[model samples]
Target: MTSDSVLARKPSGQSDGFEHHLSPTAAQALRSNPLSAKATSVLSASYADSDIRDALGLLDKRGIQNTAETRRQLRLAVQKEVIDSNGDIIREFGHVAEQLKRIGLTIASLSQGCEEMKKHISAAHQETAPVLQEASDLMKQKDQVEAKQQLLKAFNAHFIMSEEDIATLTSTAEPVDDTFFAVLARAKKIHNDCEILLGTENQQLGLEIMEQISKSLNRAFQKLYRWIQREFKSLNLENPQISSSIRRALRVLAERPSLFQNCLDFFAEAREHILSDAFYTALTGTSVGGEEDASVKPIELVAHDPLRYVGDMLAWIHSATVSEREALEVLFISEGDEIAKGIQAGRDSEPWNVDGGNDFDGLKALNELVDRDVTGVARVLRQRIGQVIQSHEETIMAYKIANLLNFYRITFSKLLGEDSVLLESLTTLEESALNQFTTLMRDHVAGLQGESQLAPPDLAPPDFLQEGFKQLTAIMKTYETSLTSADSREADFEPILTEAFDPFMEGCENIAKHLEAPARTIFSINCLLAAKNILAPFDFTSTRLSKIQDTVDKHTSTLVEYQYSFFRANSGLQPLLQALAPLSDTKEDLLSIRSLDAFRPEVLIQASQTLDDFLPLALMDAMENLKNLQSSKMARKITEEAADRFCGDFERVEEKLVASDDIWEQEADEETLASSQPLKSLFPRTSGEITVLLS
Candidate 1:
């Protein structure tokens, strides 16, 4: 190769000739010259003559090997060895189309099976739908029916009454026993159940049930009452055992208090019936079974023995009523409890529902029974009292009146504290009895005062006044026991004091005035002293006794002074004046026995002896009278006053006698002395007598 061809060629390491060859145009374009010797040389080296001829034979524009040039090329001898690759690919595509047709047929079969299954599921749902819906509805109804049945069973077990129990209770032939109580217990339980179960849900049903229960109990109780009345109609209520058994039964029955109240009401009615009969019997003056004929009388004749029938009636009534009342106490029929029940019932709008404490109906019945018995007995007593006072006005003894007053006082004192119409009646009776006693005393006093003027003062005190004083003292003694008791207040004594003092003291004054003044003084003083002794034992704080004492004292001091003045004038001077009067009356001083005294010598001696003995004897008699007096204080005063007056008067008289003797002695002459000899001789004996008397 020429250098130009060698230079135009790509570098030797650029590409392998088979995997990467340049196109002829690219090769030709990369070649620099067409006629260059380097190109010619490269062509000759790559293609031998045989290779050139074969490459010219292989060339065709459409790769076909024949032409005019193809004939030529054919003649040139083309090599013939051929392989068919497109025929095998066409066979494989035919097999794949057959497999695709088989898969499409399998999918069509699956879609047809799915449609059949869906139609079967729809048919099954249609067949089961009604059954399931009916089952759900039945279950709901079954639950409701079972719940209702259970409710009915519970109500019957707790609240319903048995036929046998009801029949036994309703049957009047059956005796009251535990069965009755069992019935009541069941009834109460049912009532409580109703409250718990139906209190708010069904109030009207609860009320109806309670009403039915109440009626049933009432019917049972009525039957029991009838049975009791028939069986025990003649039972002795006074018998302790029977009464106790009955009371015990009542208390047991009272456990069911609502039902028991009806029974108690029945008992009260029975008691009232018996009480009415008894009261009627007593009113008609009819004796009971065992009482004597003489033991009772009509009320008008009660004064004959007022305490007999009246006292018996009172005692019997008290015993009967008190026994019944005690039984009621066991049944809770107290006044306090009943009053509280009334208050509670009034406060609550639903009064029937409250406990109310006690049975108001039973209490009312009991109260009526008590009031009837008490009122009936009190009426009889008052009537008897009135009759006695009216019938025995003139004949009743003072002591009997006193005893009647005392009886009334004691009997009514127990009742005075009670606040009832019965107590009011008792109070009226008491006041009436007191008035009767007062009237009797007033009448007696008037009679005494009227008769006082007829009594002669020359005698002792009038008989009426004496008897009155005696009566007063006896009354004081009788009433002392009453006065000390708490029931007899100070006011009770006022009437007695008023009655006694005024008339008796007036009588005393009249007796005193009728006497001579000196004797009157002593007599009045003694009478007053005797009165003081009689009155000293009593309390007369507001009475006329004090006034009597004042009158007595007043007369006493006057008497003392009067006696003193009399003694002062007459004590030693009277006889001396008589002795001097005869001597002064004679022509000459006679000085004889007749002239010496008021009479002969023997009379003078008697007169002088009498005068000498009088003072001591009088003083001794006064002291003896003082010794007999009950009060030494009064006696002492009398003794002191009388003695002082007598002593002073005698002393003054003695002084006058002595001064007269001195006058006679100083005036005497010879003839006068001869005349005075007899007088002077008499003077020493007279003076001696006076001295001896004084001693």
Candidate 2:
């Protein structure tokens, strides 16, 4: 290879070839740059001998110069270009080395300055370390002092009550206004918060504060109680508008139950005197001031009319009760929750205030107060009403008074509870009146049971029973309009029933004993039916009416049997029945006409004649027998049922006779049977014929 090709080729395992072709510096440059080596190889390959010869030939054909001079000049130009490039590279290296020397000087100066800064920082840290630690500790102490100051401020605000608050609570000079309530509430809160303080390690502050608050609250409550008592003393129940101050004071004072109840007791005592005087004035037209008002008439003006007198007295009491309740209602009803809390506080402080196992109830308290106020009025009412009931001899009037008492009893129960003195008085008076009525009835019934008074000839109910029923009807009418609850009306009226109707019925039975069997049954039926009809209009008397109906049914059955027996004997079937009754247990052949004397042809013919005679008038006579029965429907029903039963007996007799006829026909020859009547011809009346006649 030529020298250029040898320079372009990479040195392989043979170092001699690469060393012989390139100088040491050139070979080192080629080894350092593989890309430059590959480029030289490509240039060498392009300029091969054949390519150079082709180029020389083309140049000769083109008449251009192709000589060794041009080749030598190109080689010299390449050497000169490489020398210039090396020179440029040496200049660039010199510039870079100068710049690096300047950078090293700058770095040395920076290193010396850093050492000085490190010494200064170390001295500054050593000088300021204690100062920073002291500042941090001072800040921590400042925070702790601030936190404690804040805690003290909050503690004072929560647990302390001001002198102004204490004065508002305990000073009677200050009115019990909204401000007073606010201060009282704050005091209460302070009192409650002290409990938390008591739970801590130190309880001295809590105990001291609790004692101070307790004294203040007690004084406040005493003032309120006294104020309420004074207000009640000056209160006018005639005008039903109580002042708001009194109501608010009452609600607050409920916290101290002993004081609150003492105030109520005082108020009730005052009202009792006032109402008692008012009632006496209304009754006698005599005022407490001892001057009679011309415009006000005394209820005693109507004393001759016992019902109107008693009613007027009770009416006055009821009106007074309503007015009293209305006047005082706001004191108990308004702000009930606050009042309940106050009462609970009172219970917490004073456990003995809870009485009779009853919790504090606003409405119940109002009722009890009202009852106490009316205590005097109730005593007068009971006495007067008792006198009227004892002196009244009219049975109906006495029963009416009892009803009036019962009406007032229920009215007062609604107003003042069932246990109130007013209600108890009314109940006692009512019972007394009812007993008076019962005694009157018993006396009347006893008089009716004498020998001189007997069942009427017509077998109708006696006049006394009718009169008693009329009175009973009136009593029932009064009771029906009473205020008793619907579910309880039946039981409520039972005593009245026993006193009135039962005694009348007993009188009827006693009178009935004077009559014969059928008459007695009819009389008893008439009385029972009368009682049933009188009691039928009221739904509450269903049980009593049912008992009366049962008696009527029993009596009706007896009357039916009596009428039926009358028909049987009057129709001449009694003897025949007697004979048939014996034959019923005998053999079939024994039931023949020849077996009994009563069934003989002559006897049968006589019975047939009697039956024919009676069948035509059976129902009319039976109806006439029970004509005295008060219920015409019942009379007709009894007549029909009895007639029907009589027809049934006749049908049985006809059946027996017909059956005997068949035996007679079989037993007798035609001559004997023809001479003696056939059983059918003897008893010619069939049950159908009898039934038709009765109908």
Who wins the TM-score comparison?
2
Choose the strongest candidate by lDDT.
2
Kindly list the per-residue Cα lDDT of model 2 for residues 1-695, writing each as its tens digit.
23443345644453433434778898778767888777555444534478765744554565434356755675686689899999999999999999999999999999999999999999999999999999999999999999999999998787777788878888889877888878878877888888998999769989998999888877877767776887787887676566877777877788877787788889899999999999999998989889997877899985669889999999999999998887767667765567767777778867665452456678888899999999999999889889988888999899889889888898888888888989999989988998898899888877766646677778777788888888888989988888989989999899888877887788777778778887888888877877778899998899998888888889888987888888888989899888787565233654454657887778888988887887777777778877777778978887788878878888887877777777767877879876877778867888888888888
Clashes of each: 2, 0
* TM accuracy, model 2: 0.75
Question: What lDDT does each candidate get?
Answer: 0.56, 0.81
Report residue 145 deviation for candidate 1 (angstroms). 9.4
Model 2: CA > 4 A from native? 1-166, 199-202, 236-242, 293-297, 302-304, 350-359, 584-592, 595-624, 630-632, 667-688
Q: What is the lDDT of candidate 2?
A: 0.81
After superposition on all CA atoms, how large is the RMSD of candidate 1? Answer: 25.2
lDDT of 2 at 21: 74
Model 2 weakest lDDT span, ten residues long: 1-10
